[model samples]
Target chain A: MGKPPPISNRVRLHRMLAGDMTQAELGEAVGVTRHTIIAIEQGRYSPSLETAFRIARLFDVGVEDVFGWEEQP
Target chain B: MYQDLSFREKSAWAMGALALIITLFYLADVQPISWRTGEAPPVDRHFIKIAIATIVGSIIIQSVLAARNPKEAEAPADERERLALARAGNHAGFILAFGSVAALLHYLVHANGDLLFHGILISLLVSTIAESALQIFYFRRGG
Candidate 1:
């Protein structure tokens, strides 16, 4: 398995704010599978730029709001 | 884990299992004859049987899976899934190349064509199984 990306996301939180949207619903809205959404939410995988833009647009947030770099301390 | 397995992941598992079972059956059929003769046996009924079985089995299994999840079946691989597959395939390719090279070197020393053939064949099967297993692992690890 590959290392997890050094990124964090508020996708789950955004989903909750967006009418408690389910992962599958968000995935369909953003043209990815639910498993991909789950991986993004869990920080196990980083989204492509296109997917990141899609998620931000869906949640009406900037990419920075949806995702943040996790600096190693 | 099984319940939460995605359709693609399930397909990987099924294909891996099928590859293993078929390879084992092929070996069981051919190895004994090769051992009894202590010579390189030509391809015969077992080869034909395995070839037909693999193709037919894959079609049947894929049909059943597609029937169960037509939407996912039609879905293209996502970015992460594609990455995982590529990585798995890359490793499998390395294994195949290394095994083939080793088999050629062994043939140089022993000049036993039968051993070389069996070695290369088994390496191909192992490479396939390794690719599938690695895909399953990657899928579970969140690719």
Candidate 2:
């Protein structure tokens, strides 16, 4: 089981790159809930493949660019 | 509607609402009965209410499903939804089964009829709440 992190620097960076795209707007683009976008931003959860692809596509970047591994144990 | 969350999360929203309302209604009904009699009913009023409620709930659920996509309801749960539900159920089953056995053993040892009734009743209730909680968790976490 994974725990949620306090903040997702990746998502923060994504927003910065996009000129402050809100969660609902990101969710709408990715076909997910606003809650999910929030979760991603907060590191509470990760998205499925299709959604990841959608997000990456919207940001004009690869999935790896949008999501990154946390500093390891 | 928000796009592309799985159907299970949507169903969980409906089911969780039904579970909460029905559980509260059941407690409201059963509490008075238990208090007056000082005994839990041998039969499950909760189960009965859920069954009845689900009948209406299903109609409402189906209607919403139709409103969303008629074809979707006709199709079975998608792979992710099925996996989420199965995982949640599988996780919850352990507690449910343990609770039942513990209740039975308590009855065997103590032989308190009223307590047995309540123990089993509470077991069912706990299982239901756990199931709903797990669904919510799975919905929040991806499947």
Number of the top TM-score candidate: 1
What is the alpha-carbon lDDT of model 1 when measured against the actual structure?
A: 0.87
- Highest-DockQ candidate: 1
Q: For residues B1-143, could you state the per-residue lDDT of candidate 2 as single tens digits?
A: 65554455666667667766766776787778788987666567555775688679768985785678554455565334555678889877887788888888998998877667667666666676677678767666644
* DockQ value for model 1: 0.67
lDDT of each: 0.87, 0.68
TM-scores of all candidate predictions against the true structure: 0.94, 0.58
TM-score of chain B in each prediction? 0.92, 0.72
Tell me what TM-score chain B of candidate 2 gets against the true chain B. Answer: 0.72
Query: What is the TM-score of chain A, computed separately for every candidate?
Result: 0.94, 0.77
Docking quality band of candidate 2, CAPRI definitions: incorrect
Residue A7: error of model 2 in Å?
18
Which residue pairs come into collision in candidate 1? none
